[model samples]
Each structure stands twice: as C-alpha cells, then as structure tokens.
Target: MADKPTVTIIGLGSMGQALASAYLEAGHRTTVWNRTPAKADDLVARGATRAATVSDAVWASDLVVLCVLDYAAVDELLAPNADVLKDRVVVNLTNGRPDQARRTGEWATAQGAEYLDGGIMAIPSMIGTPEAFILYSGSRTAFERYEAALRVLAEPKFVGTDAGLAALNDLALLSGMYGTLAGARHATALVGPERAAEFTTSLLIPWLQAMANILAPSSAEREAGDREAGDLPSEESPLDMQAAGLANIIEASRSAGVGVDLLTHLLTPMRDIIAAGEGDVLTDLVEVIGKEIRS
Candidate 1:
C-alpha cells in the first residue's frame, strides 16, 4: 500500500484533537503539540508522535493544521518560530475576524510559508463526517496540494485567493445563525418552557425550512441587484405589515413576562426602512440595514 501523507496538528483542544484523530484514522502520520502537553496523551497512545516544542511540531510535517482558540493564541504560539515554517503549508482554522486572518496570512507569507485561512462549520463531534464542511481561502496552490489530506477532516471548500474571504463568509453565516437563534429564543420564551421543545420541533423547524426556500431565491435577487425581480413585493410580505407584526410580538412577549429586547432590536431596522418610505420592497431593508451598519 502507498504511504499516507504526514500531518502536524497544533493545539489539542476538543476540535484540535478531533482533527488529529481524523488524520490518524485516514492513515496519516500525525504529530501533535499543545501548550498543555498532557492534553496530547491520548493521541500519543494512539500511535501519533508528540512534539515537545512548537518548532518540533512545525518541522515534523509539511502540512500543519492549527485549530487554536483564537488568533491571539495562534500568534503567541507561532510568532517566534517563523524560520521553521518556511516552505510549509499552514492551515489555520482558528475563529477570528477577516482582518485578523488577513494580517496573519501576510505575516506567514513574509516568513516564506504558504498560508490558508479556514473556517470550520461544524462542531468537534462532527469532524471527519460529511456534515462538516470547511471553508478555506488564500494560497490556492497549498490548498490544491493538500486537498486530498484536508478532505479526510471534512468537506473542503476553496472560497477564494484572499485570505480574509473565509473568515468573512464564516462570520456572515454565523451572524445569520445567531440572529435566527435570537428570534427562536424569543419565540420559545413567549410560548413558555413546557411547550418550547414541542413548538420548536413541530412548528419552528418546518416553518424556518420553508422560509429558507424563500431566502435562497431572495438572496440570489439581492446579489444580482434585482430586488424587484423575484417573488415581487405585491406577492411578498410587506415591511409596514412586518413592522406592525413586530410591534405585536414585542407587546405579546412583554405581556407573557418575557423580555422584548430581541424583538425590539429587530424592529429598529424595520422602522428605519418604513420611515424612509422604502417599505414597498421588503427585501430593500437589507440595503437599509447595511447603510445603518456603515454609519
């Protein structure tokens, strides 16, 4: 049989460990390192090598994957070892902002390392499963070279050449998730604890799935700058009507002894769009919200 590729994993947190485990399962020779060395005990026991220092880990393999806690932690760990990283492919899957990823990519490039910034869209438990999809950007050459190895960890998505693209897309997707969760929390609170689970499983999930169908086409329209094209305003929900309904939601939540904070926050943009008399196209609120953000 052909030999498997070698991979070094830095950071032995839950996600980091999962990454290492997946590489090992895929028959790769794995080297692992963590600030807390004891955290790597299990991996070492599973036939993986343990590196005593960050430089040792970097030198152990050409393909290095970092799943550290944050960009700050990544800097602290790798900043002093630039010399060891030369000609190496460093894939950083740390959760961070786009600017941070861009800065890190620049630093890595200066040190002669090929860098790929990644956003992991799954929890640790989902690593190595089809459900996990990893978004990567920067250093297309490095990505292509290591694509086979990366696929063992998750479904690999090469987003763009800009190092910040992955982080930007990651944060955007997360923002949507958090916004949806905030609305769900308010809904559950209004319904009370006893029926919250049932409501979510029975009503919210199916309703949101159907709403997702609308959002998919709406997003395409927004991207094409043709807000009037898809599912016209006459057939769609109106902003004035949505704002009025939000007011009712806020009032109802307060009456039910739950906080109206989330619903009230949502109403701000709707009110802004309504006052500007742009309520004719409900989706135009996206532009209104973006303008508010820029201001």
Candidate 2:
C-alpha cells in the first residue's frame, strides 16, 4: 500500500489525541504536540512522533490540525509561530463563535497559511468512524487537496466559502440539541427521578422524535416563505392555544413540586408574539423570533 500523507496535530486533549490516532491508524506519519508533553506518552507508544515545540509541530507537516480549547488558545499557540506557518494548510477544529473563526482565518491568511474552520459533530470515541461527521468552510482549494486525508478522521462536509459558515451552523445545531436537552430535563423533573429513566427510553425519546418529524415540514414551509400560509389547517390548535398549553405545563410542574423555570421561560416568547399581534398563524412565531434577533 502507498504511504499516507504526513499530518501534524497540536493540542493533545482527548479530541486532539483522537484526531492523531485516526491519522496514525490510516497509515499517516502523525506528529503530535501538547503543552503537557507527558500527555503524548500513549500516542508516542502507538508510533506517533512527539514534536519538541509548537513551531516544530507546524514545521513537521504541511497539513496542521488544531483542536484546542478555544480561539484564544489557538491564537496564543500559533501567533508566535506565524512565520513557520507559511505555505501550510491549518485546519482549526476548535469550538468557537463564527466571528472568532473568521478573525482567526484572517490571521492565518496574513501569515500565508491557508485556513479552514471546522466543526466536529461527533465526540472523541466516534473519530475515524462513519458515525462521525465534520463541517468545514473556507479555503476550498486546501480542502480539496487534503480532503482524502481528512476523510480518514470523519466524513468531511464542506459547508461554504465563508470561514465563519461552519461555526455558524455548528452553533445553530448545538443550540437545537441543547433546547432538546432542556426540554428532556423538564419532562424528567415532572415525572420524578424514579420513573424518569423508563420514561425517557420508552416514551420521551419516541415522542421527541415524532415531534421533530412534525416540525420538519413546518421548517420547510418557513424556509419556502410560506409563513403567511399556515402549515397546519386553521382548524388546528392556534398559537394562543399552544401558549395556553404551555401555561398548563408550567402550572402542572409547579403543582408537582418540580421546577417550572424552563416552561416559564419558553412561554414568555409565545406571550410576546401574541402581544405583538403576530399570533394569527402558528408560524408567525418564527417572524417574531427573527424580529427580536434583528432588534
């Protein structure tokens, strides 16, 4: 078999280690560096080379992958070695905001390195597996050049040319996930801990999945600019009725000695939409949210 391309990984955190391991397992010459050199012990034993310094790591390979704590840490580590980064393709898988990713991309460009901001959707254990997927944006040329190597880690999804695009989508997806988590916690609290496990497995998971399926078409309607055209029949429960149902949830939680905070917070926006006289169609809530975001 042909030897794989060499890859350098900075930051030996769990995710970073997973990345290096994936590359190594794919037969790439993997060079790894971390602030705590001892963290690379196991990787070194696994045939990964340990770089003596951050600059050495950058110099080790043309494809440098960074999976650090944040954008700040990324800057702190790479800023001094900017000169060494020239002609390298630096792929940052750091978790950060869109603006931060854009700024870092600019900095990398200034140092003559091609930049691609990436968002890993899977956890460490899923690395190198088909279950893992990664979102990437910016430096399309670089992405195409190294995409084969990247696919060794996970499925590479090139989102757009904008450096911030991956981060934006990443945060948006995570926001949806956290919202579901909050809803699950509220549901479990109302049910009591004793039955929460069974409730989640047998009921909550399936119900939430069904609810998601229902919302999918509504989302498509909104995207297609059919907000004025109610996705559901007018005979269906209106926004006001939905708000009342939320109110009932809050009351029931309070009565059951469970915290009503999540339900209360959720209802606030629905009430705001109603007060703004935009609750005629259920999808009007989307417009209300867009307005609030713009304001």
Candidate 3:
C-alpha cells in the first residue's frame, strides 16, 4: 500500500480541530493553522505540526482541508496562498451556498489546484465515527486520490462533479433536520416538559423512525426536484382527514395555552390549497411548491 498523505487543516475551530485530531490519530503527518495561533496549541501537543501561517499550512500537505467560517474567510485565507496551491487538493468543509461552492471551485481550478467542496453531515463529536459521513462534489480524481485519507475523518460520499451539489444536499439535509426538530418541539410542547423525556423515548422515537423509513425515499425524490405527479404514492392519508386532525391540534394547542404558529404555518398554506380546489392529498403541495420554485 502507498504511504499516507500529509494533511493540512486550515482552521482551528471545533470542527477543524477534530479533523486535525483524526488525521493525527490515523498517523498521517498533520499540519494545522488558525488565525488565532493559540487555538492550535492542543492539537500541536497531540503531535500535529502547528503552521505559523495559512500559506505555510497549504505548503505542508497535498491534501489541504478548510473548515473556516465562510466562503469570504476561505477566500481571504486562500487568495494569498494561491501560488503554493498548484497541484494540491483543497477540500472545503465550510458551510456555504451552492453558488459560492461553484465560484470557489472555479477559483481553485484557476489556481491550478483540485477543488472538492465538502458537506460534513456530523457534529465535531461525531467525526471518525460510523455515524458521520461527508459529501463531496467536484474533482472526482482528487477525491479518488485522497479517499482513503479522507475516510479517516468520516465516510466519504461523492455526490457528483458539480461543485455546488455537496452544498445543495447539505442544506437540504439541514432543512429536514430543522423541520424534524420543529415538529418534535411542538410535540413536546403538547405534552409538558416533565413528560418530554418519556414521551420522546417511548413514543416519539419509534413513531418517527417508522415515519422516516416510509417517507425519506420519497422526500429524497422531492428534494432532488425530480418528483412527478405520477410518482406520488396513492393517497394513504387524505387531506380532508389531515386538515381535520391539524385543526383539532390547533384547537387543543390554543386551549393548552401553547403557541399555534408552527401548526398554522402548515395549516394556512394547506387550507389555501384545499380552498383553491387544486389539491386533494397532502403530497399535492409538493407539486404546487415545485411550480412556485420553477417560476
């Protein structure tokens, strides 16, 4: 087998430090740099080389990972180091928009470097665990070259060649997570906090696990903007029944002195669709939203 590649981590935030630690633990030569030099002290103590500057960090490794604040910070750190970036592979795990990823990919390519935009799907604590997986897009060759090294951080998922694909899917996954959390919060509010722990553990977890298993595949299709009307399953739960249940939920929440904002946010558009005489099932809303997005 080939020798492990040296890895350079360009940010020392919690996530950046985790990445550096994983690399160091895997016995890769790890170099780390942060704007505030003090942040790298712990990692340096763990056998990581602390680079004095961002350019020096880039120069230390063929695989340079960036987990900085944003695209602006990424650009600020990288622009000055462009000369040294040639032939190197840059993996940016920063949170950013799809367009920003595309633009950054272009900029990196112009600098004669291979760019792979990354979407980290786990928290810092989850890095290096089986539960953590990262999405990558752009420069398939670069990804293939460093796939083994990258897996030291998390399972690597290559989404596509479009630089923005990773960011797009990342935001989509986060949207699902926030939506799930909102519903869970509303459910907990329906029960008092005293009961939340038991409710979530005994009822909510299994219920949601089953629902997710049933819904996730279809949700994936809708999210990809590829769902056609015919692709929707036969109406298992009609909107009329759903609307009645939702109305009852709203009434109960109001009676319990709980806010109905989240429920109403769903019900209002739902009622509008039903009133507009354009929808019969809940999934119909997907078509309407798709059209709105297209327009």
- By TM-score, the best candidate is 1
Please give, for residues 1-295, the per-residue lDDT of candidate 1 as tens digits.
0566689999999999999999888889999999999999999999899999999999999799999999999999889999998999999999999999999999999999999999999999999998999999999999998898999999999999999999999998899889888878878889999999999999999988776666545666778876543343344777788788879988888889999876675688778877987665667667656866877
- Model 1 per-residue lDDT at 16: 97
TM-score of 3: 0.91
TM-score of 1: 0.92
Where does candidate 2 clash, by residue pair?
A: none
* lDDT score at residue 278, model 1, on the 0-100 scale: 64
- Cα error, residue 26 of model 1, in Å, equals 1.1
Model 2 residue runs over 4 Å out of place are: 1-3, 218-235, 291-295
The count of backbone overlaps in candidate 1 is 0
Candidate 3 at residue 24, lDDT?
89
How do all models score by TM-score?
0.92, 0.90, 0.91
Q: Stretches of candidate 1 above 4 Å error?
A: 218-235
Give candidate 3 regions above 4 Å deviation. 216-232, 288-295
For model 1, the local distance difference test gives 0.88
